[model samples]
Target: MDAIDPVVGFFGLGLVAGMLRSDLKLSSGLYDTLTIYLLIAIGLKGGFELASRDVTALMLPTIVIVAASAVTPMVAYQVLLRLGRLPHPDAASISAHYGSVSVVTFAVGASYLGRQGLDYDGYMSVFLVFLEFPALTGR
Candidate 1:
């Protein structure tokens, strides 16, 4: 999909860097700064999109999103352990990475849909925020 171009491009850049044994690395402070900036930007966007919407409309979807987020990592862990035969810690780590929602992907998809003149709800961003935490914690 057109939405995945940036993701693929970045992945290619990282792969090339690794293959070349490049010395490029992000400092801890810089990493932390970028992480905070991205998180705040996404949160602010989602918050503004959600501010005027009805809370009652979001309640059921929020419950479902949280529940699915809690369950997905467990299922992924089991599959990685049993089928892939990965070590427990490796399986768990991979599952956690796979299970978490990618907010960047959501933003890109939303942008693509907008460009294509498709309609979607603003509450979907709220759902993306909802789907972030429980997957990593396996709560």
Candidate 2:
């Protein structure tokens, strides 16, 4: 093949690798447990830093963050559809996932913010969960 189609090649290679694997698989049970642990760790770490900050100053930014987080996906979906030629539902779904930043990103960002003497609202942590789960279950 002169040019490998990335999406097809990814799954093709994955299927071959799975068939060839010996004992490197992690069971679904363990993967779920790891995910839960990771989420809790991020929440705890964020909560601790949030507790350290002055709560009074973050109220407005917290509201702003939540609104921006929700609305950004719609904007992204339009861009992807018009510029990238993705279909409507596909673009919207993917845009939602990307717009909702993940915990690891949040965790690293929160750490940076704290180190830089900036205070962020803790409820943004809750908003992250809301953003990801609904999009997932809706599909």
* Clashes per candidate, residues 3 or more apart or on different chains: 0, 0
lDDT of 1 by residue, 1-139 (tens): 5555554555568679999999878899997996687668767877887897888888988998888887888899999999999999999999888678776567667766777789987667778878886744544
Candidate achieving the largest TM-score: 1
Note the Cα lDDT for every prediction shown. 0.78, 0.68
lDDT (0-100) at residue 68 of candidate 2? 73
Candidate 2 local lDDT, 1-139, one digit each (tens): 2464443454466568789883655699997896687689767755776787776776676667656766778788888999989999889888887676666556656656766679876656755665565355544
TM for candidate 1 is 0.69
The alpha-carbon RMSD values of the candidates against the true structure, listed in the order shown, are: 4.4, 10.4
TM per candidate: 0.69, 0.56
